[model samples]
Target: MKIAVIGSKGLPPRQGGIEHYCAEVYPRMVAQGHQVDLFARSSWIHLPWYQSCRFHGVQVISLPCPGKRGLDGLISSSLGAIACLGKRYDIIHFHALGPSLFCWLPRMAASAKVVVSCHGLDWQREKWGNCSSCLIWLGEQVAIRCSDQIIVVSEALVDYFQDTYAVEAINIPNGPASYWQSDPTFSFVKLLGLEPQKYLLFLGRLVPEKCPDLLIQAFQRLTSTGWKLAIVGGQSDAPAYQMNLFKLAAANPNIIFAGELKERYLAEIVRGAGLFILPSNLEGLPLAMLEAMQEGIPVVASDIPPHRQLIGMNRGRLFHAGDLESCIQMIDWAIQHSKEMKKMAQKAQEHVQTWYGWDGITAATLRTYESLLCPPRSKVKPATELIQR
Candidate 1:
């Protein structure tokens, strides 16, 4: 099958979840004998417009885009959709609500089956202005009306679509990134002034919705426990919010802002953590938390629906979302109860390893694509019925 992918920033997955997801899923599809052309942003790739590159057997084609926040996504998606009109693709897949705005272009101009993957409700995010939010909302409506299939990352999102739009979306959760073993010598962590199992880690984009500020404030209120706080991630067009978080941690020398550690450095930091924390108000199955859990690290997260789905049933600890006091209490409890936290970490690691493997996710996604292409003979009969015969 020939597939055209739209809505990711670019290949090597420097930051965003969508890019990482594409990096994992699409290349496996290529290995399975499907050709995938991923349309990316020139701004992200740092390449000239319309330049093409290969990433793990997938063709990544960079398209022109403005450097502005909202405009970049809109312009790149529009151009990607326009490019799809010239190709004879079997599937035209889009990644987020913002890019799904152009899902109609392929359906109108070509004979491709359209698939839209909603990572999250971007309109609900705190960073976007009202105009951008409204545009994202409109894109959601367009995706519902135009796309042949809709894929959501969490059960909460599946319920949201069912209740709000009376539509059923395929529920496919994200798989964890490759698990890494840090150097036993702890060479890199020592340079950062961190010791193994002596620091709390917050790993995600420094955005308002993720609420790194809440973590900083909560950490500040705790009495001296010899546990340093390491905030590890990049800014996502939210420099002001990131700056405010720095200010929140300004008085404390123990608070470390280790900006964007990739590969082995990231692995070492995550593995050395005493506790992993995410105080997010919104999420669509957080990949950071998933990776932490896969590393067998104990997690403390806000009690959002997606978090509950992942960490509920005694898998990990949860605090009330956006409540500073609740966050403080949860962190205190997790720290004090070391043995219990370790037990929960073991359970969480087992759960992720059993259910969230990337190979399974890729195969499930392929089945969805194949089902669309080779649908049952009769609309009233189930596909299973044909298989039974």
Candidate 2:
């Protein structure tokens, strides 16, 4: 089948869950003899060599877009929809609510079946202004009403869509890195003077919704110890909030700011961490949390549904969302109880491996596509069973 993917920043994705998800799932789809064309924003197409337009087996189409924060997706998706109108693709898959705003254009213009993957409720994010949030809400409505099929990354979202819009969506959660381990002798961690299991790690974008400041504040209130707090992501959509996080961390020497780690270093840092913490107030099955759990790192997260779903009672500790006292208590408990945390980490890793495999994600996505293309004759593939809520 011929597929055109939209809504991701680019291929070989360095940032965002949707981009990383596409990077993992599409390659496997291409390997299975499907032709996939990905539309990337021109600003994110950094490599000079990639200007010729191709990555992995997927065709990369770089389109110029507005450099503004919120306008990027709008402009890119608009151009991608225009291009798809002529390309005659079997499926035009849109990722995230922002880009799904344009899903109707292709659905109305072409015979291709339109598919929109709602990674999260973008409107709820604090980074977007009231107008932008309203626009995103409109996007969600369009995605539900216009698309032939809708894929949700979190089960909570399934309940949300049903309750609010009365729309049915297939739940397919995000997958983690398959069996990754950090090298103890990794140069990046060594350069930073970070020892194995001696620091607390927080990985993800620095945004208001993510609540990085909450973690920094909680870390500050904790009694001083040998352990350090390593923040492992760069700013995204919320510069002021990022600045506040940096300012809060600046007051304490124990807090180390390590911006936006990539691949080898990312895994190494996560593997070396004594504990992983995510204080996000909102999430749709965070990939960072999954990645950390897959690395067998014990976690302490905000008590949101998605976090609770991944880090069950047996796996890790959870504190009430946005509650400073609760967060501090959990962090101290996790730090003091080293042996128990390790046991919890092992349980979390086992759970992640059993459920969130990349191969399983790819197969399920393909099944969704096949069912759309061959509705009457398509047989349910056994791989669909792998994605158990």
Candidate 3:
């Protein structure tokens, strides 16, 4: 199949989960003999016009994302969609809802099938600006309506789409990056220069939305002097928010804010950690937690829909979002009964193998595409009428 994959800042994921998702999935799609073309944004100021390059048989056409973010996604994907019309592609798979402006172009192309995989809706996220929120909501509405199929990362998101937009979405969680396979011979204690079996980890963006401050405060209140917290993620963008986190960290000697470790080192840290903490406000099946769970690290997460949907009630610990006391108590509980945490880690590893591993996710995604391309030939049959594989 000649597939045109639209939306993103080009293939080598220099940043963010969406880029990581494409980086993982695109190569697999290409390896399966699908001639995949990526429509991405080129940040090069030297380029005269759009440029094309090949990586693992996938053609990456890098165009400029207008105004760099919300505007860039909206425009670059639209331009890619316009160009795709003349390319005679079989499938137009757009990565995120932000690129919905292109749905119109694909909709007019009767020969092409449109599939939209919304990583998460921007408007639903609390981070969007007022103007961006309005624009995103409008775009997502068009995207959900025009696309032939919608793909989501979590059952919670699927429910959201079904209930709010009345759109049906096939659930497919994000897969792991290729680096997950190798053994880095990593030790969290050695890396942090701490005593063996002694530290808790909170990994992800250190922003207000991620609630790193809550984790910091929780660490401060915890009575366990033996256990310290390592806060790993990018620096917060909003200065005031960053200041707040730093101030909280200042009050607590046990909290260390290690900003954005390199990917390999970070993965090693995750594999070596005693526990993974996520106090995020919102998420669409966070890749960070999934990655941690894949490494068999027990998680202590925010009691939000996305986290609950992934971890379930028994798999790991859940504390109320932004509640410092609840988080502190949960941390204290984990520290005291280290054995239960280890058991939870084992459970998490098993759970990951069962449903959240990369290979399984990739296979399911392929099947979704297949189901869309090839429907049942006969008339509607009872759900039981379908033969079990």
Identify the candidate with maximal lDDT: 1
> Distance from true position, residue 116, model 2, in Å?
0.4
Q: Write the per-residue lDDT of candidate 1 for residues 1-389, one digit (tens) a residue.
A: 99999999999787788998999999999999999999999999888989899999999998998887888999999999999998899999999999999999998999999999999999999888899999999999999999998988888999999999999888777888884667878788878888788899999888999999999999999864889999998756677887788788889998999998888889999999999999999999899999999999999999999999889999999999999999999999999998999999999998888777777777767777887888883131222221110
What are the clashing pairs of model 2? none
Question: Can you list the residue pairs that collide in candidate 3?
Answer: 66-72
lDDT of 2 by residue, 259-337 (tens): 9777677888888899999999999999889988888899999999999888977799999999999999999999999
Instruction: Please write out the lDDT profile of model 3 over residues 3-85, one tens digit for every residue.
Output: 88887777667667888877777777888888888887776222324788876677888776555556667778878888889
Segments in model 2 whose C-alpha atoms lie over 4 Å from true places: 46-52, 178-183, 379-384
Which candidate would rank higher by lDDT, 1 or 2?
1
User: Which residue window of length 10 is worst by lDDT in model 3?
Assistant: 380-389
Q: How much is 383 displaced in model 1, in angstroms?
A: 16
* Top-scoring candidate (TM-score): 1
- TM-score quality measure for candidate 1: 0.94
| Candidate numbers, best TM-score first, in rank order | 1, 2, 3
TM-score: the better of candidates 2 and 3: 2
